[model samples]
Target: MKKVLITGGAGFIGSNLALKLIEKGYEVTILDNMSKQIHGEDYTKSNLYRNIEGKVKFILGSVENKEDWRKALKNIEIVVHLAAETGTGQSMYEINKYIDVNIKGTSELLDILTNEIHSIKKIVVASSRAIYGEGEYICPNHGLVYPEEREDKYMSCGDFSVKCPICDVTVKLKATTEETKKHPSSVYGFTKQAQEEMCMIVGKSLNLPVVAFRYQNVYGPGQSLKNPYTGILSIFSTRIKNNNNINIFEDGQESRDFIYIDDVVEATILGIEKNEANYQTFNVGTGVAITVQEVAEILKEKYNSNVKIEISGNYRLGDIRHNYADLTKIKKLLGFQPKINFNTGISRFVKWVETQNIENDNYEKSIEEMRQKGLYK
Candidate 1:
């Protein structure tokens, strides 16, 4: 059995992937710091690692620590680097934190591979669609264009669509291909772009097998309901559970390509096993775009909660108007396909959310931090 070390292996996605890898007859090891935001203040209290308890080797550590990487990488054949600070809004204020964990952590991993003698030759890291910024759009006159992130001028007036650069007309949001030029609009996005670039560049030079999955908005069970800066599904679920109204940001029409956790794991494992994935970047998404308003409505209907859904007209400064991935590359090369649609996936997710204890609603506090930094408008 091949030995696999998954950094950030205790979080929602990492934990899910670890279990599947173990079942597939691979020796599995998990390395996670269990950050207070994702795993809560007390490590004993977090149920994040409960599902994988006694199933795999667990190391309580951060990826930023070279000592931790050295310890975790022992005899490991494949490394899946999923650990990073994932908050777009929070990242605006916590600039150094993002750089340290996401950017520096990856660099440290590269240093280990280059400097040390290790069995590890393959690395799979989590990248994000946010690196595409507003992504690709098609204007009637201009054909296809990759627009910039929506400005406050248009967002202020509640016009929440990417317009053509030449004509200033509303352009249709198209499926963003892997070839789409990267134009990240946030500090978080910048770090992810840097992480992916560094990995690919270094991996090629060293003849290391590296796969970067540019993941869309991943949602499903085992997500951190306590973390406000998590995916929109978790944020809204926590708010609804507490009988608090959800303030839908920016017309609620701004969209994301929400993919389920299981599908994400499947795509990742396929990349790990396939040789064609060597030093390649693939976009992982359901390839189906869903609006924020639609997501809130589905959750409300399922929960049957009377908690008001307010279209607050509030917009975040570093946010994009719309984005969804073009999964053609993954499908063609890795023979991967998303198994769950948003409707079915969210239904399963809502069931899981109902079973768990309602986490404290820290939504406002997250907003305040961004607002102070002038990132939240």
Candidate 2:
């Protein structure tokens, strides 16, 4: 069996990928610290573990530690590096932590792989769409495009503006491609860009095969609803299940290319199989943008309940206006396509959430109780 080491294997995407690899006859070993707030209480009993129980080897450790990575590298043929601080808004408040984990942690992993893990042939990295900050540019055939661009346009200003055909109107925000520029607006995005750069530099210098996947909004079951810092789908699903009011930050017009977790895992596996994916970056998304309002409506319809949605005028810092991915490259390169549609995925997720009794007691108290019960072991 092929030995694969997946860091952050207890998290959402990592765990899903691990289970898939195991099913494909790969020996999967997961190295995760399980430090997220929601996972702190029942980290071991998390939905991830429950789903992939007894199928893979689990190691309790952090990617920030070099020794942990060195030990995990034994007999490993491929390394799937998915461990990182992923909160976009929270990253602004904890810049050091993001850098330490996302950037520095990646650097350490690369160092160990090049120096010690000579048996490892390929490394797959998880990147994000936040790298492309708010900017507008002209694309061939697509006309002018503006999704996360800055608010103040040169033409919008009174003077020092040139009037052009593509300059006046906002173009249809097509899915972003692999060729998209790296102009991250938040510290999280910056760190992801740095991580991709590190992978490129190390792969070129050491002659190692590295693939970086720029993930869009990934959501499905096994997400931690208790952690508001990650997974908007989980947060909203939990709130809707509990009959709590859903909070909308903006006018609900800001859209996102929400891809299912299964599709992300499929793309990842295909990336590892296709030699062309090495030393390259690809966008893993559905290539379909949906408004926040549409998501709320979908949930409401699925649950068959009237959930109140309150729109908050204030927007989070470093939050982009809109973002999506162009999956043309991955499709052409890997011959991969997403099988799960949004409605089907959401329905499956809602059914799974309904089974969890998070509203039986206060959220904090229940989490503490689970901790006392020793579910994290």
Winning model by TM-score: 1
> Which pairs clash (backbone N, Cα, C closer than 3 Å) in model 2?
134-148, 134-149, 135-149, 175-326, 176-326
lDDT of 2 by residue, 1-377 (tens): 89999998878898899988888999999988887465747666667667766788888888899988888888898999899998876677677999999999998888886676368888898888888764334544455554443343331242211122344544445456778667787889999999988998998888889999999889887777767666777777777777877777556777888898999999999988889898989888898888887888788788887989776543454666677777778888899898888988888888888887673213334334433543211
CA lDDT scores, all candidates in order:
0.91, 0.77
TM-scores, each model vs. reference: 0.98, 0.87
Looking at model 1, report the run of 10 residues with the lowest lDDT sum: 43-52
Clashing pairs in 1: none
Off by over 4 Å in 1: none
Q: Candidate 1, 155: how far from true, in Å? A: 1.5
Query: Model 1: per-residue lDDT, tens digit, 1-377?
Result: 99999999999999999999988999999999989998888866778878888898999988889999999999999999999999988888889999999999999999989888999879998999989988888899989987887778988888877888788898987899999989999999999999999999988888998999999999999899989986999999999999999999988888889999999999999989999998889999988888999999999999999999999988888888888889889999999999998889999999999899988999999998888878777
